[model samples]
Target: MREEGKSIDEAINIAGETRFLPVVLTSITAICGLIPIAMNPNPQIAPLAIVLIGGLISSTILSRIVTPVMYKLIPPQMDEKI
Candidate 1:
């Protein structure tokens, strides 16, 4: 689609929508994985949870930053009659 000169919206719509699910899922998984560490009575999983949580937050922010840039970089489709 990028090679075909399709616009960001067009390519995105074609590919599904929003394209944020994977990012959202990853963030959720990270937070979930940290639960055991965060709530651990033994304190062994605390570091793991912290790292996962941090990564999830970073990824979410990065996604927000990158999505718009990607959309801008990709040109929209020109043939509306098709």
Candidate 2:
């Protein structure tokens, strides 16, 4: 929401604070699934593990780009008091 003068910390804090519980739960679920695949000996699970690993890495990278751009475009609420 840079357009409206919201800082990066404000946007991230707003997003994280609003969705904290659900995000944590989802992350936990993903980690649970990922752990099994990551530890599995089966060759078939190897690809799945690789895909998840790649996606996790890619998403981490892209978030740096996406968050700032999104903050610039969305124009966060001014009176929300984040």
Candidate 3:
């Protein structure tokens, strides 16, 4: 975003705003996809469903909160872009 002349806050805000809906919808789809597999007592794939659900929850929280906080803490590298 700095390469596009946006300030740090502007960059973070734009990134967060742009990502929110897609991330939310993707998370919803992942959870929905896992539900049926998770509910069924499959000896083979049931564990995958549990792991995927946990991963989805973890990633959603990180993307929504931790990522923005990290963005605030980490400045763009000087050599990376303008």
Candidate 4:
């Protein structure tokens, strides 16, 4: 979006909106895929699966909320010409 000359806020908004579906779908798919492993009676695999599920959930939530807010708060770096 910025490459197309959109302002920072517009770019951020557009990017966030554009990425929302894919991110959510991927996360949901991964979580669902991991469900059987997470429920496994194999202790080692089950714990790993549980951790991965939690990580996926936390990262998905944080990226959706924190990323946009941080982008808004931080100023974009400008290229310095000699």
lDDT winner between candidates 1 and 2: 1
lDDT of 3 at 1: 80
For candidate 4, lDDT tens digit of each residue in 1-82? Answer: 6656789989888889999999999999999999999999998899999999999999999999999989889867766658
Over 6-35, each residue of candidate 1 has an lDDT whose tens digit, in order, gives 766676665544567777887887788778
Error of 1 at 74 (Å): 10
Q: Is candidate 1 or candidate 4 better by lDDT?
A: 4
Candidate number that wins on lDDT, 2 or 4:
4
Cα deviation at 37, candidate 2, in Å, is 2.2
lDDT of 3: 0.88
| After superposition, candidate 4 runs with Cα above 4 Å error | 80-82
- Model 4 global lDDT (CA atoms, 0 to 1): 0.91
Worst 10 residues of 4 by lDDT: 73-82
Q: What is the TM-score of each candidate against the true structure?
A: 0.56, 0.49, 0.79, 0.83
Which has the greatest TM-score?
A: 4
Pick by lDDT: which candidate is best?
Answer: 4
lDDT to native, each model? 0.71, 0.68, 0.88, 0.91
Model 2 error, position 42 (Å) = 1.3
Candidate 2 clashing pairs? Answer: 1-71
How well is each residue in 1-82 modelled by candidate 3, as lDDT tens digits? 8778788889888999999999989999989999999888978988989899999989998988998788789875756534
Backbone clashes in model 1? 4
lDDT of 1 at 63: 71
